[model samples]
Target: MYIDPSKKPYPFCPGCSHSMVLDAIGRALEKIKADPRRTVLVSDIGCVGLSDKYFNVHTFHGLHGRSFTYSCGIKLANPDLLVFNLVGDGGCGIGGNHLINAARRNIGIKVLCFNNLNFGMTGGQHSVTTPFGGKTATTPSGSPEKPFDLAGLVSAAGGSFVARVKALDKEALDETIAKAFQHEGFAFVDIWEICTAYYMPANDYKKQQMDELIASYGFKTGILREEKGREYSRVLNSAVRFQTSDVRRQTSTTLTATKFSHTLQKDSIGIIVAGSAGMKVIFAAHTFGKAALSCGLHVSQKDDYPVTVQSGHSVSDIKISREKINYLGIDKPDAVLIISQDGLKEVTDILPKLDNGAVVVYDKNLQIPKTEAKLIPIDLHGLDKTVHATAMLAKYLTLNKFMPIEALRSAITAISKDKIRELNLKAFEFGTND
Candidate 1:
C-alpha cells in the first residue's frame, strides 16, 4: 500500500476534496505499480502539504510555493526518479514563475495542482485560480481578478501533457494521474476541488456548481494537450560531455608544488574574510580555501552578501581541518580579516566574543572593537582597495602559521587572470613583507 498503515485516518477535514484527491493519487500509483522507493512526493505549505506524512514514499515538504523548484532540482539531479508535486492554487500563484519555467523546460515532473479557488488553510481568501465573481473571505462580494486557466497556461508554456479533471471523479482522477506519471516530459493536471471548510460555506459550492463554473469560464475539461518532446534532463545529458583527462592535465599544470610543514593548533580552524561587496572578499576566501586544499586539508567556504550587486558588505566563512569538514558554519572564527569600515561594522559584535589567542588582521586606518585576540594592523596606502582582502588574508596566514605563503601564491596564480594575477601576487607580497 502506498499509504502508510500507521498514518491512517488522513488529516483532511471531513468532506474535504483533498482527501478524495489523495486517495486518487494512491490508487494511481498502485495501478502503475510505481516503485515507492524511487517515487518522491513534494509538497508546499497548505492542506496539500499535510498529505506527505500519510504516504510511505520518499517525501519533501518545503516552504509554501517552492515545491516545483525543489522537484525540478530532484528530477534534474537524477532523472530516473518519479517526482510529483501536490500543490494548492495559492502555491501556484506564489510560484507561478517556477511553474511556467518548468513547463518551458519540459522536465519530467507531474504537477497535480489542487485548484480549490481559495487559500483554504490560511483563510477563505481568494487565490489566483479563484473564479471571477466568486465570493471568498477576502472577496466578500466577488473576486475582481480573472481565474487562471492552468491547463491552457501550461499548454501554452510547452508542457508535453496537460489535463483538467474534477477531484470527485475517482475513476477519471486515477486514470489521469497514472497517465501523468507515465509521461516522458512535463505533465500538469489541474485538479478542480472544493474547500469544504471555507470555500463551500462561503459560496455554497458543490460538484454540480464546479462543473457549471468551469463551463462558464470557457475552460476545457479532460486531457487538454498532449505532445511528445525531448525531456529536459535527457537533452541536457546528451549535449554535454566531460573530458576528465584534459581537465586533470590542466589542473596539474596550473597548481604549484607547495608543502605545508606546520600543523594546526586545533582540530579545525575557522577564518572570516569580511569586506565591501566589490572588494573580492569571497574570491580571496575561496583562494585561501584552495591553498589549504592543496596542502591536503579538507576545506569548506560560505559567502554572504546583499542582493544589491556590488554595493554592500561581503563576508565569507572558511573552515579548514585535517579531517573531513562536515559543517560549513563558523560560530567562532579562529582568524578574522577586516579590510573596510563596512566589514568592521559587520563583524563588530563577533570581535569581542572571539576566543583568547585568536588572530585578527585589519586595515591600520580602521578603529577596531575590543577583543582578547591577538591583533595585527596592515597599512593599505599603496594597494587597490579591491585587493585589500587578499593582502589581509596573506598576513593572517603568515603570522598564524596556518600554511606556507608559497601555497597562497600558487592559489593566486591558478585562480586569477593575467593582470588580476599580477595584482594579487603583488598584494600577497606586500602582506608577507609588511
Candidate 2:
C-alpha cells in the first residue's frame, strides 16, 4: 500500500519497520476518514513519539508508563475526539500497569502498539515481547526466558477488542486497525512489526526469509468479539463497565506473547539486562568485548529483566571465562566499587546469592556487609568523575592488566589524552582501583 514516492523517508535506521506500521495506521485513518482535527495521539518513549513530527494530527509523548492514562484524560475531557495510542510493546506491555487500569475503566481510547519484539530507540535490547532464544544487542547469547502473549493478556484484562497483525501483512494490518478504532471502549491492536535493524539477517537475507515465510504461511484477518459469558466483555459493550475490583491476578505481572517468537541465539548466559544507560554498556561491549571473542572467550547479553517500554534502565554485560580474570574474580568480584548505597545493596544481595565473595568499596561511609570478604573504602566524595569515568576505569584496567594496555589506551584516547591522564591519576591516587 506504500507507494514509492508516497513513502516519505525520515531518520529511521535502516530496515526499521516503524515506517510500515505508520503507513498502515495512515491507511486505516484514510479508509475510516477519521477527522484529524478530532484525533489526538498519545504515545510513549521511542520512535513512536516521532509521530508528533510526522503526522498532522495532535500528538503527545506521555510520560513513561502513563500513555493510556493521558489518553484516558484526553478522551474524558473531550469525548468527541478520537484518541489513538501509538506505542511500542514496551510502552503498552512493560508499561502495562497504566494500560490495564485504563482498560478496566473502559477508557474510550484505542491502542496501536508496534510490537517490534525488542527496544529500538536505545539500541536493540530485549523487551517483554522478545521471543525466547532471540538474538539482540542485549541478548547476544539469545533470550532465556519466554515472551508474554500480549493479545491474550489484553483479552484477559477486559480489552474491548484485541487483534494481532504483522508488518508483512498490510491488508490485515489495515483491517485490524479499522476494527480497533471502531470499537466502543478500550481497544488494542498488537502490531507485530519486525526490527529490521536488530532482529534479522541483513536486508537481503531477511527479504528472502520473509518471502519463504509468506510463501509457506497464510494470514487471516478478523475482529475478536467478546463472547456473552466471557469475562473480557466490559469493553466492546454499549456502556463502560467500571466494575473492576480486585481482579488483579498473577497474570498482571506476567508479559504475554501474541505470536510465535522469532529469536535466534544458541549460546549460554541468556541474560537480559535493562536498557537506557544499559545501551552504553552494550555499546562498550560491542566496541570492546567482541574482540575478546578472538582470544577464544565468549559473551552474551540477553533480555529477561524488568520494564516493557523502549526506554528504561540501561543494562549490558558479558559472560567470560573465570580462568583468566585479571580484575574481577572468576568466582566473585575482587572488589565492587559502590557509587551509592544502592550499588552496595545490589552487590551485597547478589554476594549472598552467588558462590563468590566481593570486597565492597563505598563512597559514603556505610555499614559494611558482615562476611569473610574484605570491605575497602574509597573517598571519591567530591570528584567530578562523570566525563572521565570510562577513561579513568580504562586506566585502572591498564594498571591492573584487566585489559591490554593497547586496547585500554585506544578506548581512553577515544576520549582525550588530558582526560586520560587526569582521571587515571585521580583514580590511582585515590586507590579506587583496589
Candidate 3:
C-alpha cells in the first residue's frame, strides 16, 4: 500500500476534510500503480503537513509555502520520478509566486492544494484565498479581500492540466487526482475542504452546504483546463548541450601539475584566518588550501561575514588533513590569525578556548585577549592591509616547516593576476624573511 498501515490513526481533527483528501491521494496512487520508491511526496507546513508520516513513499517535509519549489527541483533532477506536492490555502497564498512560475515553466510536478478558505493551522487567520465576507479568527467581521480562483489562475499561467474538486466528492477527487498523476507536465488540483477545528466552528459550517458555498463564491468544479506541451527539463537539456561541453573544455585547459615536498606533522589541522571586509581574507585562505592540496593533503574552507557586504568582520575556517575530511566545523582551531581590530573582536571568545600548544598570530598593534595558547606578535602594519592575511599564513607555515615556501608562491601565481600577484608574492617573501 502507498500509505503505511502501521501509521494507523492519522493525526487530524475529527470530521476534518483533510483526512478525506489524504485517502483520495492514496487511492489515486494505487490506481496509477505508481512505484513507492520512485514517488516523492513533498509537504508544506500546516495541518496538511502532518500527512507525510502516513505515506510509505519517499517524503520531504519542508518550510511553509516551499513544497512546490522543492518538488520542482526533485522533478528536474530526475524527470523519471513522480513528484507530488501537498499544500494548504495558506501555502498557496504565501508561495503564490512559486505557484505561477511552476505553471509557467510547465515542469512535470503535480500539486494538490487543500483549500479550506482560512489559515486553519495558525489560529484560523484570513488567508489570501479566503472568500470575500468569510468569517475567520482575524476577520470576525468577515474578510474584505476576494478569494483567488486557483484553477483559473494556474490555467492562465500556462499549466498543462488544472482542476478543482470537492474533498468529500469521493469519485471526483479520486478520478481528478489520478488524471493529474498521469499528466506529462505541470498539473494542479484545488481540493475544496473544511477546517473542522477553526473554520467550521467560526462559520457554523455543515458538510451539506459545501456545494452552495462553492457556487456563491463563483467557483466551478471539475477540470478547468488541459493541454499538451514539451516538459521543462527536456527543453533545458536540449538548449544547454553545446554550452555544457564548451565549459568542460575551457576548465580542462587551465589545470596545472605540481610536486609535493612538505609533510604535515599532525594527522589534521584546523586554522582560522580573521580580518576585515575587502581584505581578501577568503581569497588568501583558498590559496592556502590549494597549497595544502599541492602537498597531497585534503582541504575544506568555509567563510563567514555579516550581511553588510563591505563593512564587517570576515573569517575563513580551513581544515587540512592527511585523511578525507567529513565535517567542516572546528571547535578549537590549531592556529588563529587576527589582523584587524574587527578581526580581534570576532575571535575574542575563541582565543580563550585554545589549547596550550596552539598558536595565536596577530598584528603587533592590537591588544589580545588572554589565552593559554602561544602568542606570536608580527609587524603587519607596514604591509598593505589586503595582503596581511597571506603574510600571516606564510609566517605560520614557514615557522612550522609544514609546507615549502615554493608551494605558496606557486599558488599565489596561479590564483592572482596583474599587480595583485606581484604584491602577494612580495608579502610572502616578507613573512618568510621576518
* Ten contiguous residues minimizing lDDT sum, candidate 3: 250-259
Q: Put down candidate 2 lDDT per residue, 1-434, tens digits, no spaces.
A: 21233336755777677888777787888788888888787888877666656666788887765788888777876666788898887777658888777666666688888878777787778888876677777888888877777776777777777776667788888888877776777788877777777666422225455445334434333455443222222332323423332233321321111111212122222121122332233443343343233333443433222365333433333444423434321234343334434334445554443323434334545565655644444455555434222322333333334334444333333444586446544544344343
Q: TM-score winner among the candidates?
A: 3
TM-scores vs. true structure, each candidate = 0.76, 0.48, 0.80
- How well is each residue in 127-226 modelled by candidate 3, as lDDT tens digits? 9887778799899999888888888888899999999998988999999999999999999999989899888888887676778888887778898888
After superposing candidate 2, which stretches have Cα over 4 Å from the reference? Answer: 1-7, 202-222, 226-434
lDDT computed for candidate 1: 0.88
Relative to the true structure, candidate 1 reaches a TM of: 0.76
Over 107-164, each residue of candidate 1 has an lDDT whose tens digit, in order, gives 9999999989999899889999888888898999999988888888889999999999
Q: Considering TM-score, where higher is better, how would the candidates rank from best to worst? A: 3, 1, 2
Candidate 2 TM-score versus the reference? 0.48
- Assess each prediction's global lDDT (C-alpha) against the native: 0.88, 0.57, 0.89
Q: Is candidate 2 or candidate 3 better by TM-score?
A: 3
Cα lDDT for residue 172, candidate 1: 91
On the 0 to 100 scale, the lDDT of residue 40 in model 3 is 98
